[model samples]
Target: MVFLSYLFVLPVTLLVAEVALLTGATTLAGVSAVITFGLGLITVPIAAVAQGYHRAPDALSPTTAVVWHLTSQLWDVGDRIALEQRRCRLRSCMQRSDQPFALPRRAVFVFTADPADAHVRGNVTRSRARYLYRLDISDTYGQVFQRGIAVAIAGNVHATVSARRTLTATDVPTP
Candidate 1:
């Protein structure tokens, strides 16, 4: 009981002192006196009886409490703003497409309408086992002419190359 009283009473007294100091009361002898007395009554009995509160209440540190509250509120607002931006960008992209082609569900071999025409147009090349299709696309023509539709189809070709490559490297397995 003595241990409980000293632990509880001393810290409550200090907290009251600190609160009075922060609020700039003229003395510890007015309305501030009544407030701190009420706070002591509430805190002292609990600290004496509860196993958890054998010492001063460490749960209400001012700095950590303020930081956690501010961080949570800021994250909530930021996430909503990010979601709205993504929705707006998606809508804008959809509006720009002349006739948007639906993506294919499964992979399949794509053949040009005419192999001879593809070869003569210099758009198709054949090696030992595969044929490749190629096209040069820029942003203005790609969206305006619905070139994504043709590119999407050509993407299914066995070995398409759209750009020039000077050198290539890959990890080779050692026997």
Candidate 2:
């Protein structure tokens, strides 16, 4: 019975602890204390039942399952947000090329441009069948701005593109 408990219940408890640690749940300190102080009591009975023994173990089982459950939920949420951000970026890029595209409320006017540049012209040609170019402008923030010049070519294509900029303390003055 003791051997069965050690082999089955003991290992399962340890495995749960390992999973919890890997998923950023329980700390090593907590796992160590919980397992050291109570794991035996918790696994012993299950082991005894499997082996037809009448007695349970002396220690309590560590609450590793709870930690694993919570960590899994956190991981799921993080994954969802990441996916959403990617989708939003792609949508923004496409919207910038769409005709009659309006700037997002939070977006400020930076500048304007004609689709005569080689790069702009090419992008328009590639997307011409899909969109009617209305107006192309750059913002003060160096963000590419475009509006729908004609009817919807495909679905709704409205996007703005922004370039990376370095900011200095002089860019913003303290009030």
Candidate 3:
């Protein structure tokens, strides 16, 4: 229902904006029209989510590029990322330290790309996610982020406030 509404609303809204743009609509006026539709004002996202379709980060993947950019920005701002369902936080992201060998601590997850994981778990397919790196976490709740490897079945990527690193600018960089 929400998706169908988006299909109808997004294009119609875009069409209006384009028409307005063609007519030399001012920026404020364009914003007003888009706001009038009530999707809420969508500014440039400071961070983005790719909904894991894989179980770990693929360095060669275009998705990795997106993650690289997004994660870099997040690191700059010192933010933690949530892996949707599992809601695990990615801190001190280390790439390719070890292969993920077991189900992540929070298989409280849903697969979006592979229907198999979804079928087996009865979760809505969102996409694949993987551990991009291997980092040790204090894990007070004892939930590790897929053992620091990405896995399949994550969706709705967004930045979070969980377990961020406590490094200051003067801290010695890890070797």
Candidate 4:
């Protein structure tokens, strides 16, 4: 978060230094400003790349890819903005549902699960086993929209389907 704040703050600092230099500031101060600006120029891109690299591994996950794709398709706002703002979260838990199996959405498979695990169940003994997952995208001011998903695991195979999507009341525009 500090790095992100630095990205926004550095430019304004540079602008202030430029103005001071033009207004007959001391040469020492001017030199210091130039050095600071030069360091910022080198560090900004490095910070940006490091931030991106942190998220890159998660982007390769099938679940993350499907969530992003679905957000682009079903969400009213731009997915890129949500992604760039880091407002998306993926959460999962083992659960049971009586709903019948539906066709899996394209590329929604995450991974196989063990059927014998009492906690996971995995739909092997009975078709009621499912993994419940939620994808949440929040607006700049903290209002959140959420999508619920169910991944049914049968033996070593698993498939995911959207269960529901909900927008927070604050997302509705005021009259």
Candidate 5:
């Protein structure tokens, strides 16, 4: 985070210094400002790549990619934003009806024996599972993944979830 910030701030500050040197606005030496601005501008790309940030994919616009990247990294589950999650038995679960395609969604919730489970989904590489994550979902890529657990899937959401592989609609745990 700090590295990316420095890449931008340093250049702009050098630009100001360059302007000051050219206009004789400050008593600073001219050679130093030119060298600083030249070095900062040249290093921007190297510094950005070194920090592991690059251009967005061809499909997405630059602004959209930036907004999504920021949203995912900034609005985390805790602190200013409170995203609730729980580990249940996954008594019953399904997907949204109006989605465009059938694939495993990014968020999955476990259903316990109760009727009114809170229905909280968590990120994939997340601790959303009770013992072991029986069900894993990745809505961003339009897919659903599951382990060796049985579930009762209802509603048209089932059709969308099984878009790729054949998912068992009745994966109940053995007693």
Candidate 6:
């Protein structure tokens, strides 16, 4: 969105402004009309691009990105906790040799997105798409803890994270 906006808006805005200024429109109404026309010219293409972006298959929705980012943070914290646990275990072992500690193995997280229900129709913003996501974070010992997550994206700007009770599985569907 950032790249597209800059590419389309900046050059077009500059060109339109220059054209408006250079073209003889000295009268008040004429200047206002020119300004309006330039604004329309700038707005139309941007709106079209934005609409296209939202509908594009390659585009990543804000909600999905937020969910992924939150899950990644959880994974990082889990790794740190697992490392500390490993260190504690090593200390208990009482290895007297002057050797560097081996790093604990990292567990891979499997993220899946469930399909949205077609029959359940709701509000445009407050839709049925909002639901609890089951996130499984595995420790170094291969024990998986389920964390229930509820993600709400308002206006595609604000994301609310509500961590509820744990579940047995994990996944999120693309918007």
Judging by TM-score against the true structure, name the best candidate: 4
Q: Which residue pairs does candidate 1 place in steric collision?
A: none
Q: Write the per-residue lDDT of candidate 3 for residues 1-175, one digit (tens) a residue.
A: 4445556767777777777788888684577475646653221111111221233433223333222111122332344544344443443131221322322223323221222222322222112221111122111121222321233223334432322233232232222
Candidate 5 lDDT by residue in tens digits, 44-134: 3444334321222222222211111001122212222211212213433333333213332223222221111122222211232222211
Global fold similarity of model 5 (TM-score):
0.22
The residue-by-residue lDDT of candidate 4 on 37-104, one tens digit each, is: 67666554544433221111233245333331222234333223222222222222122222112221
Provide the lowest-lDDT 10-residue window in model 3.
43-52
Tens digits of per-residue lDDT for model 1 on 1-175?
Answer: 5445656766766676677778875476355466656755555344334322111122222321111100011222122111121222121222112212332112111222222332322331222113222212111111111121121111111121342211111211112
lDDT winner, 4 or 5: 4
Error of 1 at 100 (Å): 93
Instruction: Give the TM-score (vs. native) of candidate 3.
Output: 0.25
All candidates: TM-score: 0.17, 0.19, 0.25, 0.30, 0.22, 0.21
Off by over 4 Å in 4: 1-26, 54-161, 170-175
CA deviation > 4 Å runs, candidate 1: 29-175
- N/CA/C clash count, model 4: 0
Off by over 4 Å in 5: 1-28, 54-135, 141-175
Pairs clashing within candidate 4:
none
lDDT, residue 82, model 3: 44
Quote the lDDT for 166 in model 1: 19
Give lDDT tens digits, candidate 6, residues 1-175.
Answer: 6446556756665666567567754464455556556655655454444322111211223344323222223332222222232322221221111211322222222222432332211211122223333333222232321112222211112123334222122233224
lDDT of 5 at 69: 9
